[model samples]
Target: MRISSEEELSGVVRDATGPLCIRGGGTRDIGRPAPGAVIDVSGIAGIRIYEPGALTLVAGAGTPLAEVEAALAAEGQRLAFEPADWRGLLGTEGVPTLGGMVASNASGPRRVQAGACRDALLGVRFVDGAGAIVKNGGRVMKNVTGYDLARLLAGSWGTLGIMTEVSLKVLPAPEAAATLVMTGLDDAQALRAMTAALQSPFDVSGAAHGDIGTLIRVEGFSQSVAYRSGKLAQMLAPFGAVTVERDGESVAALWRDVRDLAPFRGTPGDVWRFSVKPSDAPALVDGLRRAGPVERVLYDWGGGLVWVETAPGRDLRPERLEGHATLMRASTETRARIAPFQPESAPVAAIAAGLRARFDPRGILNPGRMG
Candidate 1:
């Protein structure tokens, strides 16, 4: 259904009895199959409101992320919770939508400090499967209620309902930032270094590691960033020789590539996203190495987030990954044959099912996208 207006969208949903899938920018269009008509929410796109002082920004579901970022940049503020650029990994072109980012709960290296998308979401307005326009939470922080359903729907992969507008918490941009690059540490050593820095008194905003290098980022006032950089460098000294700083342009380029997963782009391989205990990352990477030829592995969120690209034609099975592994980018055959999500416990599965039923009774919204 082409919903040009929010009211019209709600009307269409209210009349539906079977199932309905919500479609936005279609970046993750292939992630799931729609069993019924798709409610193309992209048609209802625009920024409804933005208040810098209030640290709140609300936009239509289809508002492109690029536009939102540009606006926030002009105001010297930004979404405190960094979102990822999935287009690079998917090998697709087009700006991702704000709603899609919230739906996927996508985050970048900054997640280690700034937190995830769900954490920054203040409120949400969406159309449920019953075609009712429901508002949850609020524009301000601190909402006490029976359940925080807004967050519950944030990462539901459009399986729950159609998010029409979202109010997110924003923060002023950091005064300055710097990256400390340490070269030549294996996965295990890198993970240890990152974990240590995360636990330190210095406020390390971002930490990421790849096959060739490990990076630690400090963001704050110029003097503070400088002081923390020196302290973090000393702390990471045990790992190996380290490079103190990266120029602004170079730092921006590096993080852009990091957010885009540049090293894995255009590579003919299976990509997996794993979330495990920070301490478990080393063991998982080592297990992957023993299993087969792994091309590139990027660790983020202080080793909690693992992005791995397997060798061409090699089976990147969860069983071989040794820890929790979710296939984030994969071929159709691979996705169909393997589970894309970590196996949930029975109680968690039951809770997920109940939440699904509450927002999407007919299982029409991007069914199986998360599973």
Candidate 2:
């Protein structure tokens, strides 16, 4: 079912007899076999408002990410969170949409500095299971006291409800950028360097390490960027050979690849996204490598986001690792065999269940998509 208006969507949802798989751009709609109807929201697309001076944007849920980014670029502003375009990594040939980004809480390399999609999110309008339209949060960014359901919709994976419109806070794009590369450092040493850079006053915006090199990006005015990159290099000189790449094609390409996880795109393996502390990332990688062949790995977000590509069917839960891991990429058969999402604790599961019941008592939206 394709819906262009919230009223039509609500009526369809109200009269839905079975399960529903909500789709925005269909880029991430391959999770589970559809139990019943498929509501494609791509028809409901447009940019409702963009206030560059106020740093706010409101758009329909089906608005393509490319369109929004282009609009923001026109105003010399961009989504601070830097959401990832997962087509290459997921092997799905479709444009990404804002609704999908928010649902997944997707973030790219700049997430280390800006934050995930949820951080920029200010408000949302969604349809509950009973077909009622609910709105939360406000256009103006401010501290609010109460249950913030708009933020809750993010990363809920559409189990709660179907988002119709969204409002987000944006920021000005950096004027200049530079990356200091620390080459030839092993995982342990590289993580140490990343931690040092992140803990410093140099304001590292992006930190990622892999087969290429350990990179720490600094973005700002040309003078400030150059000075900070130099200071960061001096601070990290003890680790290994450090080189600087100024803002240009090379530096932009570097971050684009890191943000998109381009290295692991064509590799034949199951990809897992690990959220672990910087101090423990190396140990987790060590344990995983000992278990099976880890085809590729990229440590991003100051080693907090670990993207690992391992041999097919390899278990990603390393010993003594205290963090969540999600199967980001795998065949439908493989994903079904092993739960795609990380399991939650009993108490946490209960809380999630309560939220789901409150928002979607009929259990009609994106059934079984989380698994």
Candidate 3:
């Protein structure tokens, strides 16, 4: 089934007798496979409003992300959260949509500084399972008294509601950007260096460690980028000689690779993602190896986000880690046997169940995707 407008979507929900699997661009295929009739929302697309001066944009949820980015680029602005393109990682083929990005909360490396997709989200329009069209938030930022549905739905993965439209806060594109690279440092040393750089006053925009090397990103006016990148090199001297990539093309390509997990593309293993304390990253990587063979490890967001490629179908959750590990890629049988998302505690799970009951009383939207 396909819906082209808000009214059509609401009608479809009202008529659905069984589960409905919500699909956008089909780029992010995480979690357990949802069993239902596919409701394609790509028809509900187009930019509705864009105020470049105000740094805000409003668009239909199904609008192609590439179109939105092109519009933003023309005005010298961009999504502050730096959302990643997951097609390569998921091996799915389709243009990413704004709604899909919001549903999955597909944030990139810039999240360490700007925040997640939810932070950039100012408002949303969606349809609850009851066939009611609900709107929360607005184009501008302000405090609201009650449940912030805009945020609550951002990363809900379409279980509670189907988003129809979204409004986001944007940022001016940096006049210049550069990455400081350091080689020969192990994960521990890389984490220490990245932590120091992030904690410093240099306003580093990106920090990551992987097979390539340890990288620190700074962006601003040309002079500012030069000064900060040079200073970062000096500060990181103890780790290794830091090479600054000042050419814009090189800097962009490198960060895009990090943002998209380019290194993991086309690899032959199930993928896992972990969210742990920046300091705990190295230990967690070590623990993952002890549990089973891990093909590759990439650290991003100052080590707060860890991506792992390991043997297919092995449960790689570290026994005593402070954070959670999510299975990002696996066979259907493996996903059915192992929970993809972190198992929530009693209280949190109760709250989630209550929210779902309130929004999707019939339990017909994307059933079992989260589990």
Candidate 4:
């Protein structure tokens, strides 16, 4: 079923009897099968408001991400978190939607300096399991109140409820950007450089390392970017071959390549996303290497996020790491045999169950997709 407005969508949801798989653009539906009628919200799309001066945008949940990006580009602004489009990596033809990114809390290379999709989200309008329309937050960027349901729902997929609309804080487009590549450094050394740059006052906006090379990004006025890029290069010179990419266009594409996990795309293996301490990255990679082969490892978020492409059906879950790992891409058989999301501890599991029960009493929304 498809809905063009919240009222129409809410009514259908009120009458739905079986499991409901909420869909938007369908580019990110690679999880375990969500059995039941499909509720496609792509029809409920368009910008409601865009206050360039205020750096805020309110839009329907189903609005295409490309559309929102174009609108922001016209005003010399963009989504501060630098959301990544997963179509190429997921191998799905469907376009990405802003709502889908919010549901997944998608964050790219810039996440280290800016934030995640959840942090930029300011307000949302959604429907409850009982068919009641609920709203939280507003257009303001700051909210220090009671329960933060808006945030709670940001990464909840559609299991919590159907998101009909969202308000996000936007940011001005950087006047210039540069990326410095340091080659030949092993994983540990690359991570050290990333850590050093992120920790310093270089205002580094992006940081990542993989089998190819380590990258450090800076953005701001052309002069400021050049100065910082040079200073950072000097600081990182001890780490091996260093090359500066001062062309804004080329640097943007380079980050996108890293952001989309381009190196691992079309490869024959299962992909995993790991969130660990920046310092723990090398150790975690070493631990995983002990188990067969890790075809590719892409580190982002100053090494906090590690994307791994392992041999098919191989388990790369660190034995005692303080972070979680998700099976980002795998066949249905493989996914069904192994856990998709990280298993929450007993206390955390109980809290999640309570929230799920409270929001979806019938357990009819994306049943078992998260487990």
Candidate 5:
């Protein structure tokens, strides 16, 4: 079923006879497959409002992400969270939509500095499982006292509610950008280099490592970017010779590869994402290599985010963990057996269950997609 308006969507959910798989652009098919009739929200899409002067924009949840980006580009602004496009990695052929970005809380390499998609989200309008229309937060950026359900709904994977529209805070696009590349470093050295670059006072914007090299991005006015990139190169000289890439297009292309895990694209293996302390990244990689047939690995967010490609159907969760591991991509059998999201602790699990019960009393919204 397809819905073109909030009232139409609410009515559909209220009258549903069985489970419903709420979908936007369908680019991100990461979570466990939900068994139900697909409710296509792509029809309820278009920009509702945009104020470049106030750095604010509001749009339908199903608005194509490209449309939003193009509109923002024309105004010299952008979604600072740098949302990633998972089509190549997930092997799903569909345009990414605004609702999907928020639902998944999708973020890219720049998250280390600018924060995630949820951080930029100002407010949202969604329909609860009981067919009640709910609106939370505000259209402008400000602090508020109370439960921030707008952010709570984010990264919820549509389990709590189905978002119909959203308001976001945006930022002006940088005047210039450059990346300092350091090659010939192992995971440990790369982590060290990334750490140093991030800790520096030069205001680095992105830090990532993969088969290519260790990358440190600095953005600002042309002169400021030049100075920072040069200083970053000198500071990181101890790791290896630093090669600075200043061409705007080249710098963007490099980060896009890192942001999207381009190296693992089209590979024949299951993909896993690990969120841990930057200090633990190298050791985690070492342990994983020792324990299994790991194929490829990439580090983002200053080594805090680990993307691993490994043999299919393998339960890669360690006996003890400081953070969490998620099964990002896998076969139907593998996803069915191994939980796609990290299992929550007893206390946390209870809280989540209670929230689901309260928001989705009928248990009909995108059931089991998170687990």
Candidate 6:
């Protein structure tokens, strides 16, 4: 059902009295199956308010991310915690909504320093499964009165409720930024170099390494960026074969592709996102490599986030890999045959069920989307 107004949405959800699948732009339709009627929230679009000095912006749930970026750009500000642009990687259009991104807790390379979508989210207004409008958090930064319900819904993937509006913390545009590109290092060496750069006081905002090259970004004053780039290069000299590309546009373009996973686009294979200790990345990748051919692997957060694309018919079970691996993106057949997420422990599973009950007692919101 296409809900144009908030009231209409609430009424439909109340009347259904069953599970509802929240859809915005429908870019990630493949990741999770919708077992109920789809409630398209894109109709509820547009920004409500933006305050530059306060570094705050509020918009309806269906507000397009492109629109939000453009609006923030006009005010010389931006979403400090960069959200991932999955369109390029998924071979879909860049039409994701701010609510979708927040709900997914999507983040890019900047997440190493800037944090995730939950960190930038200040407030949210959503309708519960009971059709009651609930508001959590506030426009200001220091709202600690209630149980941070806003953040709870941030990465819930609409399984809890349907978000109506969101308020986010914005940041001023960086004065200057540059990326240091280091080439020809193996996964272990690249991760070491990235970790070394992150340890420095120069403040590397982004660190990502693909199979062929590693990219480090420093954002601040032009002089500071230049100085840090040089220092980072020196620190990584032991890793062998280093190249620094200092152009701002080029750096941005490179990271944009990284954030979007451009290299793995349109590949006929399954994509998985593995989260493990940064030091364990090499072993995990190597183990997976032994299992089958890996099309591409992008390491983020100094190896904490590993995006692995496997050849067709390759089974990537967490039990098979040395460390845990979760299937972030997959085809319908693959999803049916293999578990998308790693099996949670009994305690964690109980807690997750409790949380789900609190938000959606009737199990009327995106049932089994995360499972």
User: What is candidate 2's lDDT per residue for 125-199, written digit by digit as tens?
Assistant: 999988899988877779474679888999988889899999999999989999998788999898889999999
What Cα-based lDDT does every candidate model obtain?
0.81, 0.87, 0.92, 0.88, 0.92, 0.83
lDDT of 3 by residue, 263-353 (tens): 9999889999999999989989988788779899999999999999999889888656688888988888989999999888899999999
**Each model's TM-score?**
0.93, 0.97, 0.99, 0.98, 0.99, 0.96
Give stretches of model 4 more than 4 Å off: 143-146
Clashing pairs in 1: 13-131, 14-131
What lDDT score goes with residue 368 in model 2? 75
TM-score of 6: 0.96
Weakest 10 consecutive residues of candidate 4 by summed lDDT? 141-150
- After superposition, which runs of candidate 1 have C-alpha atoms over 4 Å from their true positions? 17-19, 29-32, 311-323
Q: Model 6: C-alpha RMSD to truth?
A: 1.7
Q: Per-residue lDDT tens digits of candidate 1, residues 1-371?
A: 66778899888887876666777877764343456777788877888899999888988888999899999999999887778887768877666898889888888878888989999988888888777898888888886554787798877787787889888899999888889999989888888998899999998888888954898888889889889999888888989988877466677677767777888878888788888888888887787788888888888888898888985445555464445666777776666666677777799899989988887786766677667
Which ten contiguous residues of candidate 6 have the minimum total lDDT? Answer: 317-326
| RMSD from true fold, candidate 3 | 0.9
Please give, for residues 1-371, the per-residue lDDT of candidate 6 as tens digits. Answer: 78877888888887885678889877755445758888999888889998888899999999999999999999889887788877656666647998899888888888889888899989998888878788898888897757898889987888888998999999988888888888888898888888888988989998889954898889988888889888888887888866777777888888888888887887877788888889889888898888788888999888988999987546676465445566766777767667666777799899989988887789988887777
Off by over 4 Å in 6: 320-324
Ranking by lDDT: 3, 5, 4, 2, 6, 1
Query: Candidate 3, which segments miss by more than 4 Å at Cα?
Result: 143-145
- C-alpha RMSD between model 5 and the true structure: 0.9
- For residues 21-68, write the lDDT of model 4, one tens digit per residue: 889999986567788999999898999999999999999999999999
> Per the 3 Å backbone cut-off, how many clashing residue pairs does candidate 6 have?
0
